[model samples]
Every structure is written in C-alpha cells, then in structure tokens.
Target: MIEATNLAYRIEKDSMGERQIPETAYYGIQTLRATENFPISGIKPLPTYIDACVLIKKATAIANSELGCIPQEIANAIVQAADEVLAGALRDQFVVDIYQAGAGTSHHMNVNEVLANRALEIIGDSKGNYQKISPNDHVNYGQSTNDVIPTAIRIGGLLAIGKTLNPALASAIATLTTKADEFQDIIKSGRTHLQDAVPVRLGDTFGAWAQILSEHQQRIQTAATDLTKLGLGGSAAGTGMNTHPQYRQRVAEILAQLINQPLQPAPNMMAAMQSMAPFVNVSSAIRNLAQDCVKISHDLRLMDSGPKTGFKEIQLPPVQPGSSIMPGKYNPVMAEMTSMVCFQVMGYDSAIALAAQAGQLELNVMMPLIAYNLIHSIEILGNTLSALTRQCILGITANSDRCLAYAEGSLALVTALNPHIGYLNAANVAKESLATGKSLRQIVLEQQLMSEEQLAKVLDLEKMSTVNG
Candidate 1:
C-alpha cells in the first residue's frame, strides 16, 4: 500500500493504471472506476444482495482452502473478513451503482476488493497490498463475475423469499382465511361486469382471495426451487477452468449449510450460467401474485367505496385522513398503496423478462439488471404485503347492515325464482322490481309468480349465499 503524502488517500493500481483511492475505503481500483463510471441511479447495492455475495466469498474461501487451492492462512483471513461483512460490518464499502457494468463485473469486483482489503487487515497488513491477498487470485479464486453474479442472484432471491416474501405471503393468507371465517355469515351482492349478478357470502370472497394467494405462494416456491441449483464452479465460462475438481461440490455443500437450503450444482453448468430463466421464472411468479393483489386491492376499495353513495359494504380501518382538506375523509390508502407496489412489481417483471432474453453467446450481460429487479421486487412486495396485512386486512370490519341491504335489494335475487318460475318470469320480475323501485319479493308476490310459502323457501339470503345451497 502506497499512502499519499497527506495520509488521506492511497494509490491503487489496476490493469488500466493507478488512481488515488480514499484511504478509508475498503474497495480498491476497479470498484473506484465503477463508482466514477455509473451514476445513473443514486441507488446502491441492496443489503441482501451484499449478504449473498459475502456468503459466496465465505463459502468459496472455505472450499478453496480445503482443496489446497489457496494457503490455509490466507483462506482463514478471507473467511474472517467475510464473517465480519456477514455480521453487517463494512456495509457502506459496497458502493457500486445498481446500474454498473454488464454481467456485474464492477459490483463483483467491489465485493472482491472489500473482502481482500478486510482480509489484509485481518493479517495485520495495510489495505491495497494485493501481494499478500489479491482480490482476484486469492479472495475470488476460481470464480468469475459471470458465474458468481448469477449465483449471488439466486442466493439473494432465496434469502429474500425465506426471510421476507414467504412469511409475508403466509401472513396475508392467514389473515384472509381468518377473515373469511369471520365474515362467512355476512351476505353481500356479487357483481360481474360491474353489474349486480347474484348474492355471495362475504366470507367466501375473502376465502377466494386466500386461495389465490395460496396458489401464488406455491408457484413462487416452485420457481424458487430452481434457484437452489447453482453455477458457482462454472468460473468465467461453463468450462470450470482453474477450479479444483471438487470445488463445485464442496462449495455447494458449504453454501447449503450457510443458507440452510438444499443447494446443488446444476446438471448443466453452461445452461445455469447462461440462462436467466430461473430469475425470470421467479419474477413471473411475483408478477402473477401482483396482478391478483391489484385486483384484491381494487375490490377492497370498491367494497369500502363510500358511506352514502357507494357500496360501503366493508370498512377499512382509517389509518389517516385521506384528503388534505376533507375532515372525515379516509381513503383506501392501504389498498391503493398495495396496487401501486404491485404495479411496480409487474413493471420489474417485464424488465426481467426482456433482460432474460437479451443475453449473448455464453452469458447474460443483463444479469445486474435482473438481479436488482428480481430481489428488489421480492423484498418490496414482501414489505408491502406485511404492511397491508397489518394495517388493512386485519383491521377490516364488515358493514353487516349495508351488506345485508345490498344482498336483499339486488335485482339478481330474482334468479332464485328461475328454477321455480322459469327464466322468462324471473327476468320479468327483476325488470318490474327495478322500474317500480320495489323489492323482488314484492314484485314476485304482486304477480303471484309463486306462493308465499314457496317464496319464503326460495328467497332465504343465507341459503342463497351458502355454498352448495
């Protein structure tokens, strides 16, 4: 390490040449160039992504050491450095922009340099002293950005799903299921094509939403299984050149223990490294979930539309004043926020799809974009859903009276008379009830379409709304 005369900066050299780096920065030359190169987005690398990279370094260090590829002392230092990072130290050192170089070379090197410097410090050496611990030759031995980045993305996604998204989804599903049971007795008008169609149990609506989320969870989990297959040993290309013969298996076993996931090497390392399909698959699953969430949010807003002029069949907990000036206004802000987040997730999914297909011969240069969007989508969605469940779903209360009134008033109630009075007669009763502003019972009774005894059995709202009734 060559410190500047002022002691504030140090000189670090790469293949292109040397530059003055801040003395305190753990990152070295290539990372410094990336920071200077890409300022498109002010966003830095996400912490989960950082954790993924660090875990990879730790696993690789152990594997390389065990294989006698790197000195045991050096590998021990590297492992200690990675452990410090994993424990949340030196986080701000990972400074590469999310929109940096193709195939994430810049950000990969950022991780490498930070670990190398930290390992140097562990060995009581000065930072930027690559001779003792080179980022490429020691810290990132037998690894390449092409393989490492994709593996990092996979691990990052699994971590996010296990730690964040899955739990949120499970919570939301549980809340919906409980609400379904709680609201089962409340009957409300069901709408199709924005027109009153029939009566349904409000509980069933929540139950249906729960089922939708459950299915989405299964799809996401299935997609996540693909993430367990890693291409870490593939190195620069699928060839696995320079890697120890046992490096791939040992690293997979090591990483599995670290992540607590059933990780394995891909049967086709080339395909794993080259294809962004796993990321895309997970992204598409998230997109599917987002679409339904948007619909569910819209349903919430619709059900809670107004106290006077709209449905108002359900009341969402008023979190804050919905309007700037309206004294009692309480918009469906939670639901609205959910829709917005889901929309963003959908957009990220689209970007991931395009990027998944944009790869060339042996690797996808678009991995960085996919990495950011996929992991970010999972995390933000997890966060949003958790908030939605806590702030909205759990606090919701059914407007039982309003729901009953809507169910009784809906002209679709005449449909029960169809089997007894025939379709044409039921249609006539519905039309007359609408024109006269009278209840379907009154119109049917006035027309004597059925006896009072028959109407009593046919028009029971509970039985009509009940499944299989």
Candidate 2:
C-alpha cells in the first residue's frame, strides 16, 4: 500500500491497486482516481445535482433502516451526513468532472464515499474505517449506479426547470404581454418574405412572441411530468435483484414527500432502466423553446437595427458600448446574448438526442453527459430569458413617428383601396408610386382616383391595422 506522512495520507485499496488518499478528504481513492482520469471539463456537476444525490442517499438510509437492512445507528449517521451535504457542506469533496464515466459510476462512488466518510466522522470513527460504515454496504445499501444516477438526473432536471426556468419564462411572457398592450396604438407595416405586405399594430408582434413563449412553457411542463416516474429501485439492469419488493414504493413515496412533487415508481422498471426517452422528451422541449428564442431575438435585432438608415422601428435598451471605434453606437446586447444562449441550448439538444439513442440492450451508459447537458441547458436558458425580459423587452421604446411614416409610405397600402377603386387601379397606383419615388397616399390623391375624404376613410391607418376592421 502507498503511504505518506507530511500531508497525512491514508492507504486505500481497490481491485486494480492501492493508492494514497488525502487524510482530510471526505472522498476516498475512487474519487481521487476519477479526478485524475477525467480532467476534461473543469466544470463539475451542478450543485442541484449533488443535492439530489444526497437526497437519494438520505431516502435510501431511511428506507433501509425501516426494513432492518442496516443497524439503526449506522443509518442514523448516514442520514445526518446526508443532511449536512444537503445543507451545502463539503461540496469540494465532489470533484469529478461532468464528462466522466458514461454510466456515472465515478460520480456514484464519489457520493457514496463522501457520505460514508462523513458518517464515520459523525459517529466518532475515523474516515476510511469501512469496517464501521462501508460506502457500498451501508451508504449505497440497496442501490446501483444504474438506478441511482438516472434517478438523480431526473430529480435535478425537474428541480432546475421548475424552480428556475419555468418562472423565468413566465416572467418573460408577462413582460412581452405588457409591452404588447403598451404598443397597441402604434401602427406599422408588416412584412412577409421581408417585403412589405400589410399594415399591423406593433403590439401584435409582441403579443405573438408572448403566445409562443406561453406555449413553450406548457410543453416543458408537460414533458417534465414524465420525469416524475422514476427507476430508483431497479438495481443493476432493472431486475430489482438485491432490493426488497416494497423498497421501490417506499422510496418513491419518501422522495415525493421530501421533494414536494408527486413522484411515483415506473410502471415498467425494466423499460425505465433501459430507456432514456424521458430525457429526450425534455431535451426536445428545451430545443423548441430555444428555437423560439432565436426567432424572437433576430426579430428584435432587425427592429432595432439602426438609428439612421435601417428599420429603426424600436430602440433596445443600451447595456454597453457596441463598438470600440464607432463613437455613439449601442447594440442590442441582450438580444444578441439571448441568441447565443439559444444556439448553445440547441446544440445540447442534439447531444442529448444522440446520447439517448445510444443505449443498448438493458442500460444506457451515457447518463453522465446527458445529465450535464440537460442541467446546463436549463440554467443557461433560464438566465437568458430573465436577462432578455428585464434588460431589453421591458425597457424597449417604440419609434411611433417612424412606424407611422413607414406605414404611410409602404406601396402595399394601395391594397386598402382595392374595394373602393378596384384591384386594377390599386395595382397601377402601387406601381406608379414605386417608379416615381412618391408615397402611395400622395400618388392616390394626386391622381384624384377618389375624393380626399373617401381616400382618408379607405386608408385609415388605425382601421387597417385592426383585426377584422
């Protein structure tokens, strides 16, 4: 066995070999080796994920204790240690990278070892004294990496979406709806294929955006319900081999109570254990939401394109300087940021989709990457929605004069006189206006196709913009 003295090391052995572990570390040799092996991403699993694992340990400890599977004292110690972890203690002990082993065995062992050592310390025993409390036999009593890791992923994903993303999206929809109401009186020319087609209220554009986000929120919530069905007691490959039959139901009930969400055991444990479809569904919903955000951000950028030569229909709140050399330039920074975040989330969706389909026979060995990407997507989207809502959507100011001018000048406005002067005359009016560099209104009045009062009634901006007017 390897040994050290100046830093106070402990000898920990595995089937592969023995190694020196730091005496002060709650994590043992497995975690230390994982840290060395998977030095890929500096990012660790999200804190919500760590908390979910700790909750699983606590629930298992209580369930095992109730079934007399372990000594009451050991179970009590495990529970206390898990509680400490939930309270955010010893977070540094979980040092494995998010890109580690596909089955998440490294992360599973990290949780087991940290809780085992901490329980030993709580019971007045030294760390690594597994004879008193073993990581496998005690802390991870009836669970397998297969069941625990997937269960923890669902738990963490649900929690992040519920507590972070859903609220942020709701706030964004509300902000958009508010802006929609504020801009109802502002008339503008609407474009189809980027060509002027008809008159539309600027408010209608914001209303459409709000409706899109509302639909996405509903889709995400519906998909999240699928996550409530868990595979926790399907030890190993869904055989439920080492677990009591009642263990699954008890654990589900306990977790539901603890998390305040109605969680239930999967109807088919084998299917649940073998499939990653639930994760795929959630990822698809997130991707759909991201796509909507991209469309919205691009529209905002176009609307706020320029103050001198572009559409300039609206002005975005200036968060920072847009250029180093351009003196008085401010960009739509928030919208641009939202677009980048959506693109990243879309990339995550592709990764999750591929990982979900990569499963073979009885288990998917890609849980670690799936979990990492799902959590990251949720967090980034939530932050993006919040930033877009507060910094851009809420602070936007409509350029009413510019909007009215564009509406009045658009050649497509000739369509409003189709019934009064007939389509042939209306087409000629539009063509002459474009060719002569004159406004549609000016051309119609100069041609005396209709009296000024009749033309005014036909080309009423507010009436043309209203639905079914």
Candidate 3:
C-alpha cells in the first residue's frame, strides 16, 4: 500500500478508465487516477513492445555479470526476475500509464520496479521491496531510457516484420501469383486513364499485382535488414560513458542468440544516436505499400463496377445488400475495406515520417509516438493482408461469360485486323459496324475487306492476345 507522494505528479483533471480486471496489478490509485496522472499515447502495451523489455532484462543481466557494475546478489535477482518475464510472467505489474512524459522515464521505471518485484518473488519475497534487487542498481544497470527504449523499438519492429508482417506479405504475393496465372488466358480491353486503349489479358494485369507485391516484399526485406543494425551499448548519447568496453558486443550477442536473429552494433554510434533515418526509410516503404494497396483497391472497384451500367466485365460476389432500403444491390465491401486499411497504413506512415523528422541533437523527442505509429503500421498491414486474402482474393472468381462477351463485343478487336488491313481501314469497319448495329464480320463481308482465307489468316484473336502475353 503505497501513497502518491511527490511522484512529480498531482492530478487536477477528471479521469477516464474502467476497472474490468483485478486491481492486483496496481495497488496505488485507481486506474482512473493513474490515467489522469500520465496521459501520453492512448495505446496499451502490445507484445510487439516486449522486445524492449527483453533487451532491458538481458542488458541488466550483462551489466552486472561482466562489468561487476552492481552487486552479485542484486544481479542474480534481476536475472531471475527477468527470466520470469521471459517465461511468461509479471506482464501487468509493469503497467505504467501510457501518458507519462519525460521521454519514457515512467516506462523505464515501471520495468525496473516490476523486475525488482519479480526478483523478490523468485527468492520468496513481496513486490516493490527493492532491497533484494533494487530496480535501478540491478535491473537497469549501465543503461538509460534513451538506449533501452530505442533498442527495444528496433527489436520490436524487426520481430513484428519477421513474424507477422512478412508472412502476410508472402500470402498476399502468393494470392496475386495465383490470380495472375488464372487470369492469364482472359483477354480484355485494357484501359489507360479510364479509357480503353489496347488489349491485355486479365492474367497480365494480375501478374503486375504479383510483381508489385514482390517488389514491396523485397523493400520490406531490405528495410528489415537495415533495422537489424541496432544502437545497444551506446549508453547515454553514444559515448558509452558509464558502460564497460565489452558490454555492447557481449549483450548484443546474447540478444542475437535469445531472439534467434542477427543483431549487431551500429557502425557509427554517433550517427545512429542522432538520426532516425533508418526508421524514415522503413516508413517510406510502408507508405509505398499503403499506396500500392490503395491503387489495387481502386482498380478492383473499377473492374468490378455495376451489373447494369458500369464495366460489368467482372462481377464481385454479393455478400450483402449494398443499400439498406434497396432490395437487389451489391457493394464493393472488400475493396472498400482494402482502401480503409491502406488509409490506416498511410496514416501510420505519415506519423512515422513526422516523428522521424523531428529528431534533433542526440535523440528524437517523440519515442513513444514513434513506437506507437510504427507498430500501428505493422499491425494494420498484417490484418489487412489477412482480410485481403480471405474476403477479397480468395473469394473472387472470374466471370468467364461476361469476360468473353466483353472481349467479343469490343471494337478494340479491330486490333486483330491491324496487321493486314491497316489501322484506318479497321477503324472504318469498326465505325460502320457501330453505325449499322452490325457485327465486325458483317461490315467486313459486306464491304469485301477480305475473304474467308485472308480474314482467317490475319484475324486470329488468339494470336493477337498472344503478343501481349
């Protein structure tokens, strides 16, 4: 039972929080009071943020082990405490409210206190009794919030990319590949600028999707690689003032082993500490992906227009009535969802961009926002891809009849005759066919453009489509 003394905070505003879970996690003020005290980002802690916690834990273990920076007993306690966290424990006790200012000082302190409590628990003790393992002297040895928070962020971004975002991308790429293969034989009037220009197989268009996603996957992979370069051991502005010489590489090697990913020190600690450029590059790729998704959604909406007045070449599945009042109608729900997801990813990217740009001197002032936004991008992308595969890509089926009919009716078929008869003649025949409501065959035969042999030789739809293949 701790009282709120001069914790550098005194609440003056009404609070907003509900008590759904047990109050065992926090014994101080109500959640409402705590929230009113520290109001940063409204985001709760996600497992994506666990990388930071893990790094802090491992760093603490190293700091005491090699440097003899703190007492051996305290170091052992911190290690045992961190092991509890790694083994799935004490997640809630570290609940520092998200809004606390001072460059994530609350978060750092929360972690320290939680580890200290768990360390105490390991030796059969109660929480907050830091005597056995002082949170600062043991848990947070040889590090500051600057180093720990940033390191954790890098680890989280990399992990989210590897585990969630990468798989979603792979699935999306696979789906696109399948669509490209399926649509390969389907030739339609390919449009440029909302107007029909030439013939292209539907498969070719889908292939572009596959290839585009593949490109994004490449960029994402590259970005992931860049992110592997970390800023650990650069305690307090890259000078390593209080840290031992071997601390950086040793702890980093341990982290690499623990996370099963290659993590190395930044080649230039000064550059890394002063610049958020890597995140900027990554956020740019994320923005590109969002833009690509938006374009794809728009294309889908255009392709699967109306059954009565629009393109009608493709019919999207009718999942529900498009309008509440209208009985027979369908809307592009999947496409709209894709668009919304793209909008969200784009927004997150923008947040990252702004945050990255704000870095000055030795650190960026917006670390919390940076973590929140980048994580948002990763989560939105992961869920969006899942939705895309289940609701849109997998749900789609080609309208063979309509696709063929549109191909057959289009005057763009004049392309087949362009080789033998020339463009002007084909254009005239198309104009006559439209004028008299006659088929291209009727106009050709009546005007004596070519006989059966000549027409058959030149007007092969299969051959014409194969050129664009």
Point to the candidate with the largest lDDT.
Answer: 1
Ranking the candidates on TM-score from highest down gives 1, 2, 3
lDDT of 2: 0.90
Tens digits of lDDT, candidate 3, 80-134: 7677677777665555554455346566666766676567667777554545666
Clash-forming residue pairs, model 3: 39-99, 40-99, 52-152, 183-203, 184-203
lDDT of each: 0.94, 0.90, 0.71
Model 3 scores worst on lDDT over the 10 consecutive residues at 10-19
Q: What shift in Å separates residue 279 of candidate 2 from its native position after superposition?
A: 0.6
Give stretches of model 1 more than 4 Å off. Answer: 1-7
> 57 in model 2: Cα distance from truth in Å?
1.4
Candidate 2 has a TM-score of: 0.96
The clash numbers for all candidates, in the given order, read 0, 0, 5
Compose the digit string of candidate 2's lDDT tens values, residues 1-469. Answer: 1123458888887768998888988898888889888888688878989988999999999998898888999999999999999998999888899888878999999999999999999999999998899999999988999999889988988888987899999999999999999999999999889999789999999999999999999999999998999999999989888898789999998999889899999998888887989999999999999998999999999999888979999999998999999999998989999999999999999999999999888889999999889988998899899989988898999999999988877878888899988999999988988889987778888988899889889888889999772
Residue 460 error, candidate 2, Å: 0.9
Give the Cα RMSD of candidate 2.
2.2
| TM-score on alpha carbons, each prediction | 0.98, 0.96, 0.85
